[model samples]
Target chain A: MQKLTKEQQDYQNFVKQKRPKPPLLKNILMAFIVGGLICVVGQVIMNFYISRGMSPKEAGAPTSATMVFLGAFLTGLGVYDKIGKRAGAGSIVPITGFANSIVSPAMEFKREGYVFGVAAKMFVVAGPVIVYGMCSAVVIGLIYYILKL
Target chain B: MAGKKMGLQTIRFQNPPSIIATSSIVGPKEGQGPLKDYFDLILNDNMYKEKSWEKAERKILKEAVEMAIKNSNLPYSKIEYFIAGDLLNQIISAGFAARELGFPFFGIYGACSTAAEGLGLGAIIIDGGFADNLVVATSSHYCTAERQYRFPLELGNQSPPTAQWTVTGAGAAVISSRPQNPRITYVTTGKVIDMGETNPNDMGTAMAPAAVDTIVRHFNDTNRTPDDYDLIVTGDLASIGKDIAEELIKQKGFDVSNKYTDCGLMIFDPQQDVHAGGSGCACAAVVTFGYLYKEMMKGKYNRILLVATGALLSTTSTQQGETIPCIAHAVAIENL
Candidate 1:
């Protein structure tokens, strides 16, 4: 076997010296603040839906859908992305964030006529994931149901 | 202006190459294994028979180009020119690949945006009548890139949340004269922008400004509103950068509310360990080639503006405490 070159050995030493340390207190604090904000938004939405007399299950469904829709809309209107810029993972970690992933492209191509631009290519970014997610969820749900039976 | 009077008509191609080919040899995921183990995985394999990083990239590029050409069913000799580049110091990957391919080559570097730049230029060459058939290819390997721009993979280092996964891949496309396909009609070159970011670890922040700069230029150069193109796609400006880009575009007084999409945000499962989304040259290449191409071919999209952005930074520069400088290149593709 060929011996490692001096450059390779030096690189190995350099990497050992530069290994990243754990996140500092400031990093943790920032994550908490940002994460809390996103959760607060979700809670407010749920409360609003419940106050409107919807059942808890129904409220949860609509609230989640609404968040996704809003995220997607903002992503399209180019607003959600702005919030995400300032908030980082705070904005990206939520379910609504995924909706933005779906709609931004659709909104972008609205100029090419609705069928081709809006309807066809809008989901280019998020389509596969959604399909895969839904399929997997269904399969998992069925398996759980069968096991229960 | 030199070739403008030639009345060079822009022609489109039908059945363009889909971005199914990729060359991603090294990255964070692959770095976890032992150096000897990883080297064996890369070198002992059929893919890495070449002696050096440059040679491996060239081999991958050649294969990708050949695959694209074969998939397009165009004869090798019919390809009028080959335009390409990489993130390497002198872009030797593209140069070597071009040399081996034996076609006229035009090398360019726009960091991760080289893929779009090459495609845009290839489109222009064909449209301008300088050539009827052209090939555009770009590649980057995590192994070569790490030594050039960051730490060696042997060291177990953690990436910041803001860091993007540099896609270990290469992609190629054939632009030819087939009237039924999408045609590259317009291109807007962007100026380099620096938002004063010095952290090499967080590229999204660094690249966001560049993406914004180029998107703004595309709007200005074409005198078209956001409503003109079906989608405005930015390359490699993952989660954080995508957000910043949207904000910057809004600051320009145009509402891209419904039309902004980012390639970096698309390629990976964020929950499955890809933190900020996929990046590197392949981020835009694979998504544009694999996902977008198929949809477009199915008559899903008519007009699209692909604006790929990049941060031009090296490890040496970063270690020296130099600021991150970003650039973006835009290409307009229309299906007639």
Candidate 2:
């Protein structure tokens, strides 16, 4: 790339002085705390399901589903948005985050109609994750079957 | 009578309309800012007990218009016209308020620059004998705008450092033939200018060039330097836009760094994690009507130039892979 003009260089310097620097340390701390708390909630839910006469693996599935439902509900109630704003990426670190991904687009495009808007746009964000997950799972399962043979 | 055309893209009002009164209303976040005391009302909640954020925006706009009329000492029936706009697709916030007030209305859409555009047009109508008394109002809400332009509130996505929080507020100003201290002296309407910026997350950068264009045109047309005004304020440029604008002006052989400030940066405290600062139609509207208007009344600032900038891109347009087109409009308000 060519060197910037003197005027452009000056502009860069001026902008640097005026622009704010984010508090990296504080943001990292907040993300750690918030993300950690969300994980703890998931664990507690899993434990509850286990104590209610379910295996740990079975508990895990229900707990994840519950978290997704909670996330979507909180998003509809406008609570999660505020938390996302304050907590940054920390809020997007769990099954709840995936729920947000689905619900947000559905809500945004609801004006566009159900079939085209809600149903179609619902997976616009999450489709890639689903596709990759299935593809990888199939490949892993085939490998496991071959090893057993 | 045709107003005097001063230089290119500017109008020098022959009989400048007197700015009789101004009113501003902001959300709780802005209420906690430095200029909090100057606004007339600060909402405790975004919804104001309303069913939706859109309705809340309309409520604030109506309140601001009512407050401006009351402060102008004009009876509700006496106001001749209402000119207003907002960031909504149909600008329903302004439209709904106009419906509620039942005034002769002119709806405008300048995106974030609506406040200055409304003021400039209101002044023209008053000066041109189209109306005797008029009010210019504009508003925006964070919740209403976010869902429309970006993702829904529940997305839980991380906003980058360049993102700006939309200020939830409304501001209104009354202009009339009645002699008042601060009067509209000049208007510089801007042309649509875009530099092919497509990033929706960083709107300040997209709109900053337009701000520069208008500011430079104002100075060039009026044959006045930045030093002529006590304070040179731009609406909703936020921190990033303001810095770029200051540098751009410097390239044009003027330095306004000492006196210039942006309404976006002024209305929110940096510690609040508002990213770049505030944006939206109300960002400039509230800061101008709330803080600057009150300060001018105290004889603190004499001559002021308000240049409001806007990125005139719709969510539909952005989705279609169109670059953001932006504009800015400037009006000179002076204590005469």
Candidate 3:
């Protein structure tokens, strides 16, 4: 934090005191319930795929694809955001939220047209995650190779 | 001849310019707000049949100006100048609106303080004999402002409770040399005050100090007190900033608690799920031109101090770790 003037510091303290805080317990409970429900849905989908004679390991990719499709479809339908508003981190921490993070911006910026709008802006929210995720995977792969050596 | 300049920051108009007519147009959300009846037009959709939110905002501003002129019984040619601003970058909403207006335009940017700034300058022009008739207008759109300032419209992130919703509306007023009931008496321009606040989300806290500073200066320069005006309204302090401004003003030896409120608070009902309240250039604009103007005409408030506050922080500045600089301009409107 930057250093503040005496008056600014005092006023900041006063403002902090006066500001209303969100209900922490209520939010936590909501996140738990909503997040648990999302996981249950994923589990059910996985079980359905497994029941169709696919091995559990083989069913994983399709289950994930199905979850992403659901997330993107719900976002297109303008319902995922409403769910996210109430669910908070519950909605955000899941893989579906990742799909939402991409599709939402794509839809929002579509007004600028196809090339510059939807294509360019689709990864804006998810760009950092993709970059860092790729970088870390490379680093871990190098470490694994070195350990084998 | 006595100078028009008051104590320090205020100007006392020798011949107060009158707000002869006003027009307010709002989106569906603000239409559902408590002051719905006061607005001249309420669109069923925020898009208003436009291709983009920016275009829609420009149209809203343009219509509001035309409607105000029509209400004033003044021909379009009679309007000497067009002074307007909006929350958009380059003030494009007002700039594009002024393009179609064909009047000598003064496209200004004072963030949310555009309404008061336009009115103050418009009044000065009329009172200074620069022009007889001018239209002062301001507008803001929620979708445009959201994408520009915070996040994309469809971003599923939760806003803090202190975060305010930007009002989607436009307000315009016809200021004339003709005598009328509600006159612009005094104007107090504020200095940029930074209280070391950096958070862009909590604008209320950042701007409260500036609002209080302007309010105190207005009273001091005009030799007036809280009793002098029936109401003292801030632009968009919402709940947190309004409370802070009231407390700070009291500390500065002015008791405006009973008479003070905010346009941010006035625009949206408490149960509207807008977190703190409504904000943006349109917040004060619509409330003043629509709700308060109608109330003033009905003799509910004989005089009022409209202190419009603005946080002068850009996304680049915020990203650069700079504190939010804030300003406020106070305009005294009295029925004489």
Candidate 4:
């Protein structure tokens, strides 16, 4: 956030004009298609659970768990990241991405041994999400209680 | 009073040291690149049977050094010094490799420019009669660099268009006083230049100015133009930085576009999908030692200016909102 001198600023502008911009349209399209497919798959799983005599609300938790398991499985098989690379927001905005966020560091750091490696690094990427998620949930819950809604 | 100095920031070596031998080892991805055939060893996997990527990188460096020494037809005891570096924190790759190699080690860190830096220093050591034979080596791993500088390998984030793929490889060259064809003649060291660029994902932009600065300085110091050399190659400026440096150098009254190219652009083909191209300590190292050196041996290029560029920014430095300071080291390797 420091102010750049005129020479630096001019050079930066020159570089900016040269740098390639990402394909926004293609990225958006890929994210939409891949994200939609993942949602459809989740829907099918939920419907299957409903047909098995479980209530829609009761199936929600299992559906998410199944999705998480699937995510972890695909990550272990090393397919999710390849999809994520091109899918961009599609692979990342889902519950499966949450699984991927945790499992990836776990696998990458496995060489450091189980304790400092797997266990320690498992939450590195996901830790922020979990901490912020819980904090926001608590704040929203307090607001909800106060508003009685 | 002049001594060995050639203009400011440039050194004219007396009795230039020759590159007796070189070796390159690349991972599966880089092995699939355009310069695949130039490499000495291509691993099927990045891990190379090692338990960790860091250890794999160390092994690659060690193998490259040993292979280069072997190729030089010199016994292990002949190499008096080992100058090595890497992109890893503490340069552990070179440090660990040196520990096993057991030569008088000089562990250096010049980010991606480590190869050229090592080569310049190694040449100086040999030319100065400090050592009869010495090795200059550098290595960089995509996995290690990613985890160290950016994100985890599994993070599903998209790399920007200007972002570069870290070349997973190691390159080593044996420099000695023995008369040889291609020799290191002059070294134009670079001053750290920061153009107030802060985007870590776009290192090409950050390092381009430094590359241009060193290139211009090299031209001024040596009183040579682009026509003097068959090629003027930058380390890892890739697509974006290459263009930027090309234009900036032209603006500085030197038109090297005809002979100019980059290691980053040479390593990967257009179909490789490596955004801006390749970047890493290994980028210049592998390309120069593998492709260029072999081509030089074939007498394809008489003189070449190898300007290796590096962005000296750590994860901590970027996080602290500091501008990336970049540098380039130019070494003139020619058929003498």
Candidate 5:
């Protein structure tokens, strides 16, 4: 094989030493705008549930669930990922992102058979997160209640 | 490119054998100038300001590869090639990292399964004698990944019970001509599987089918029972995916009950506020490289089947109303 010339070697070294530059204004602004839009959607869901006269805590449950469901649904439809790509965290930072985490994998494995395939594996990705989140919330809630008493 | 020898050459159908070497670098979760701060800086103040998503991703990836190479004990000049990918359009993070490495490079995309895909391919190239040494690396950062694929952290957005925290780390591995370690023996590539789950809120459900399909295919192609290996590991299936994988394996008459594990489940303590196990390409990469490699080196386990699975979904595809297609790649590793 032919050896690299001096200039070629120098260029290669330069490339190796280069560090990636940070993002500019345009990208951050877009992230903010898209992220805001997602938040607005969340507010809409919260308002819709509250309008039905449900307690704040109760309303949160369904709203969160719906967001999760919507995220998963979009993941199933392969639409949520696109938004994630364009808006970046705008799609993934919300409750919907969590839903996508669980449902997308479950949907991927449905053909293996319902018990193991559909039901069992349905929350494969999100299981731990949900469990921990629930456990932490419970623990914190209990501590608060005890303190109040 | 070579003279053809007509004689019958002994072609063995045994599994591919390639040793694994790995490295991981994690930023502080909480502290002054925490790792997240660097990410925030890139997200909010970098030159690629509008492209903070890509910029932070590139930064994280660069750090990951550097750490991985340092851990491998192989000089940068000795790395024959680099194979990598990520969750971005054009995989700029991986691509930019490769440009810095200046090794022969190939870009890949498998959402969370990228690290496995790179390792699997690295094994193929090395075992086939195409190269003497190669590096397979992958990474994901919370700030960068979130900005590119989810929401901004400052928005106070609440994650649902189904959500998984994308791992905020990077992992890299060096595959080379070391004969005193586990070798890659077999690889089973999977077909895209989508079960028509329309809910985007849950990914475990979406990714479960892909994991099951790959595991089943690995068993089928090798005609081996689950008992054949000391451990069966999956990439980023977390708690939900692990349970589903176990159930699916049972239905096929192959029980991985005691031997199965998932990378997503191993990375963090559940009480640490990391929701679901872990997600992202680095989930498997770091665990396999940092945890598994150390265990193997210590002779705690001898034979392992690493089945890294990925959901091939992009934000654009989801927005365009496409179905979530997923795939898994299996690599068998055994101590020789």
Candidate 6:
């Protein structure tokens, strides 16, 4: 075996020095609480829509849309990014996160004007998600329809 | 002049360029990251009083370059070249910033690997005796990158949790023929690698193989093991990519398990909601120039292996269903 050089040996020594431990417990606690709260708000909104004489099936779209709207609104007001900065993946996976994604780009391009700048940039992040989502949806829908036949 | 080419893609410099100074400027979001204090400047606002995101991106590049020169204690006119690029369309950020810097500019585009690419080029230029002092800089603003590459932020669409966030920042380093510590000793240029990954949402996976290829090549050519370096860093591979690279490197018989890390992962805390972690040209740039550079200068790190990874896909290519092609450039920095 080749002898370890002074630099190589020194690296090993320095690496063993006390490094800041990962903030595991605090992060997990924050994610759990924030994620749970988001789900609760979603459930409450869904229930509110259903209580207004709308069937559960009919309320699904509006509930999701309302959450998305709130997400976008918060993102526009620069609140979601702040919460997201603190909440981690908990805030990112929610429907509001999706709204935040779209609105975040739109707000950034607001100076480029409404039609070209804002509208064009509106779907940059989520466009791929939607395009793939729609293509799969169409294929799956066709397959299901044919299966029923 | 190009340096002497050694094994596969290695470049053995005649006179290695020394990093005289480095400066990194990040947005407020990145300012709150774990390495916040390492940065030279962090704007509290994304706009930074600029009218447009593109303009703000250029401003960051300009400021970073100016800061690097100032920190180098070198006159701006003494620098011979400005080798830089950014994620904006046509890399306008670098181009516009170059106009302000008044240097002989060489506009490059290596996606997130622009920082390494610029450094590699600058090192070669200085080593080849082309010029004495050169500057390498790159920037990427989250908003500008978002609008150009993906969707506008205004749409309020949801991004997959696997999606990587573009770092809003700029990094600049002044490289001189004058002797100094933490010099760029060696460089390994990477070839484009694509394994048919089409999902743009999960970039970490798509770029991992490229990083693996470059790391393996660098190790093989240099005849050095992972034990030689204090740390090995990949540009924008994030968490998922870093894991894949570690596995792939193990398969290549190096076993760089403990020494390896990704700048994307290192920039922000895991609890900071950066999805798959950071991406963009500035991701690696800011981390290296801002954080790692200082640590190395303090003699905290004796040697570092930097492999800056870049996804070589454009908006039109991804839209056309072309699989994402990725590249990685490796540079060995050692303090002596």
Give each prediction's root-mean-square deviation over alpha carbons: 21.3, 4.2, 1.3, 1.2, 19.9, 8.8
How should the candidates be ordered by TM-score, best one leading? 4, 3, 2, 6, 5, 1
Better candidate number, 3 or 6, judged by DockQ: 3
- What's model 4's interface RMSD, roughly to a tenth of an angstrom? 1.1
Docking class of 6: incorrect
How far off is model 1, as Cα RMSD? 21.3
Worst 10 residues of 2 chain B by lDDT: B193-202
Q: Which stretches of model 4 miss by more than 4 angstroms? A: none
For model 5, the local distance difference test gives: 0.67
Q: Is the docking of candidate 3 incorrect, acceptable, medium or high quality?
A: medium
Residue B247 CA error for candidate 3 (Å)?
A: 0.7
* Per-model DockQ against the true two-chain complex: 0.01, 0.37, 0.66, 0.76, 0.02, 0.14
Error of 4 at B335 (Å): 0.4
Candidate 3's TM-score reads 0.98
Candidate 5, residues B128-195, lDDT tens digits: the string is: 77887788878776656664555433322445444566765567777876665767766666677776
Could you give candidate 1's per-residue lDDT for residues B1-336 as a string of tens digits?
A: 443321222222223322222222333342332221311122234237666555676777777777777777778888878888888889888888888889988988888988788887776666556777778888777656765666333221335666666765567778865565666666666678766566776677778777777777667655778888888888888777777678768988888868888877765556535567667776677567655665677778877888888888877677677667788887777776
lDDT of each: 0.67, 0.88, 0.93, 0.93, 0.67, 0.86
Model 2 lDDT at residue A36: 85
Q: How many backbone clashes can be found in candidate 3?
A: 0
Candidate 3: where are CA atoms >4 Å away?
Answer: A144-149
Q: List per-model TM-scores for chain B.
A: 0.84, 0.98, 0.99, 0.99, 0.85, 0.98
Those runs of model 1 whose alpha carbons end farther than 4 Å from true positions after fitting are A1-149, B1-54
DockQ of 1: 0.01
Q: Is candidate 4 or candidate 6 better by DockQ?
A: 4
Let me know the DockQ for model 4. 0.76
Q: After superposition, how far is residue B81 of candidate 6 from its true place, in Å?
A: 0.3
Alpha-carbon deviation at A33 in model 1, angstroms: 24
Best DockQ among the predictions, by candidate number: 4
TM per candidate comes to 0.61, 0.86, 0.98, 0.98, 0.62, 0.77
Q: Rank the candidates by lDDT, best first.
A: 4, 3, 2, 6, 1, 5
Residues B1-336, candidate 2, lDDT per residue (tens digit)? 344898899999888898889999999998999899999999999889886788899999999999999998899888989999999989899999999999999999999999999999999898888889999999999989987888766677778787899999999999997777888999999999866666687788778878888989999999989889999999887878888888888988999999999999999999987989999999999999999988888999999999998998887788788777889999999998
Candidate 4: the clashing residue pairs are: none
